[model samples]
Target: MSKELRSNFHEQLTEIRDGIAQMGAGVTELVPRATQILLDGDLEAAEYVILGDNEYDAKAVELEERCFSVIALQAPVASDLRSLVSAIKIIADIERSADLCVNICKAARRIYGHDLDPSLRGVIQKMGNQARVLFKESTEAYLNLDGPRAAALHDMDSYLDDLQRQFIQVIFESHAAGTIDLQVAVQLAVVARFYERIGDHAVNVGDRVRYIVDGWVPEHPYAESDNDPPEIVDGVIVPAGQS
Candidate 1:
């Protein structure tokens, strides 16, 4: 590639990176906003979060197109190609995290008049804050190419998972004690899962960041190449017609 062409390519890559960071920042902001809407029964804030998801969806589609264009036009090899591919995956994670926030808001709207006990409220707050922190750190790791910090997000997600468990237990306790009705408890339980799923998405973003930095593939059964035939063992079922 000519020097001028290389320079333009790098510039395009920078713009894509900046766009991802901007999206990540926006999604992180919604976490706390949704949590507050739930805790305070703020109908206005719930509407804002729900409406904001459309913009994020549009942004994600645009970012994905840009990444695809860069790959087609520049044919980036090795790390450049990996980075662009990872950016595409990271965009999906960020967008889904935003959708989870929207779900939380929708849950808030569903239980609009129900008041949460202090214990349930506290746990929800902690999960929201933790999810925000995870996304922020993952975005920074991507921007900085800090693989170690990106890898650490998985461990950090455990706290959010624990919070979800605790929150569910509280919901059950509150329902038993007649503090909250069963319908409200059910909505709150789903809301807890949404927060936990956001943390999962954040960890996914971090995994993509690690891939960009070092070509690391997370270990999973489906990570193998499609052309590779499945191995058959005693009583083990391989893919159909591939044994």
Candidate 2:
């Protein structure tokens, strides 16, 4: 490649990376806003998060187009090939993250104007915090090209899964004890599920980072443990609660 052509390619790649980062940041904001809306019973905030989905979708489409253009025009090889491929995969993950945020907003709408038990709120908040941390760390790993950091982010997804299980157990126990109304318990379940899905998307981003650096895709969607089943302490599973 000529020096000038190489410079232009680098510029385009930088733009693509920046676009992905913008999408990541946008979805990160959405997660917290959606969680807060649910916690505060704020219908307007929840609606805003829902409406913001279009922006994320648009950016993702643009990023994908840019990646395609780079791959076709530059004919990148080796690490460059991996980077472009990773960009394509990252855009898909970002789109799904946005969709998960939309789901959270939808859950918030269902529970709008309803009072939630403080314990349930606490559980949701904890899940939200964990999801946010995973998102931030995954993006940082991408920006820094730190595959090990990305791998660590995948490990954190298990924490989100554990928290989701605890949330569901609390809801079930509360309903069984007659402390929480069945209807409210079900809504809280949906909220926890949304948060759990957000965590899954974050792990997906981490996997993409691994692909970017090592050109290797994870066999499973979520973090996998070294131990085998039957003796496995926590199995690797996407969306959690399923084999």
Candidate 3:
């Protein structure tokens, strides 16, 4: 590749990376905003979040397309190819996390006028804050190329899982105490699930970051093995395979 061509390729990759980061930042804000809408019963905020998802979805699609274009046109190899593949996966995770926030807002609207007990409210707040933190940390890991921090996101996500369990228990107790009816309890349970899923998606982003940095994917014990098929490098297939 010519020096000018290589420079252009890197610039495109950087733009895609920045786009993904912007999406992550948007999701981080959406989580807290949706949670507040749930806690405060703000229908206007709920509607805003619900409608805003359309724009997020559109941007995600555009970003994914850009990643694919770079792969097709530039024909990146080695770490560069890995980064593009991981980026596509990361973009999906971030997009889904954003959709989960919209789900939270929809749940809030469903349970409008319902009041949550203090115990339930407290757990919800903690879960929302934790979800936001998880995404923020994962984005930072991607930005800084911090593999260890990206790996730590899995452990960090365990707390969010615990919070989801605690919130469920509080929901049952609140129902038993007549603090909330069955309908509200069910909606709140779904809301808790939305928050938990957001954390899971954030962890997924971390996994993709690890892949981008070092070809480490959780499902694969080893990135490559002797039994594996011929490798593709620099747009050519090695060891007798087609280009």
Candidate 4:
């Protein structure tokens, strides 16, 4: 590549990277607070999150377009190509996670007048906090290309999954005890599920980051996200002179 071409590529790449960082930071502020919007019935805060979702969606679309432009104009290969691929995938995940935050906000509106069962409220709050942590760590892994840490996000996701399960049990218990009416229980359940889905999206970001660094995804989502060196499997990693 010419010096001019290389320079332009690097500059565009930096811009996209910075944009991804900014977007991640924006979403982080909302995930944990979304539950508060629900519990507190803060219509104002819920509206704020909904507006932020629009911004995230717009940014994601713009970043994805930039990625495609780079691919078409620069024909990036190797790590250069991987960078674009990672950005594309990460943006999608981030955008979806933000949408889930909006879902939580909408759920908050539906339950505005109905006080959540105390038991269910605790679990939802915990889930929201855990979701925030996952998104933050996932963004760090993506920006730093920390494959081992990114791979480990799955372990973190398991905790959120457990919280969701606990939410279910609590909801059932609350209803059985006549502490929470069926309508409120249903709304809180949707809110909990939204938080759980946000965690899943963060894990997806981690998966993409690991793939960007390592150049492959395990056939299964559950595969370890370690920095272990690759090994031969059948003909997959043939030796230097042995095809």
CA lDDT, every model vs. true structure = 0.84, 0.76, 0.84, 0.79
Candidate 2 wrong stretches, greater than 4 Å = 221-243
Candidate 1 positional error at 73, Å: 0.8
lDDT of 4 at 65: 98
What CA RMSD would candidate 2 show? 7.0
List, residue by residue over 10-55, the lDDT tens digit for candidate 4.
Answer: 9999999889978888788888788788779999988888776667
On residues 12-71, what C-alpha lDDT tens digit does candidate 1 reach at each position? 999999999999999888889888888899999888778778999999999999999999
Better of 1 and 4 by TM-score: 1
**Which regions in candidate 3 have their CA more than 4 angstroms from the true location?**
220-243
Candidate 4 wrong stretches, greater than 4 Å: 221-243
Model 1 scores a TM of 0.90
- In the order shown, the candidates' Cα RMSDs to the true structure are 9.0, 7.0, 11.7, 12.0
lDDT rank order: 1, 3, 4, 2
Candidate 3: lDDT of 117? 78
Model 2: which ten-residue window has the lowest total lDDT? 225-234
- Candidate 2: residue 165 lDDT (0-100): 97
Task: Judging by lDDT, tell me the better candidate of 3 and 4.
Answer: 3
| TM-score versus the correct structure, for each prediction | 0.90, 0.87, 0.89, 0.87
Model 1: how far residue 232 lies from native, Å: 42
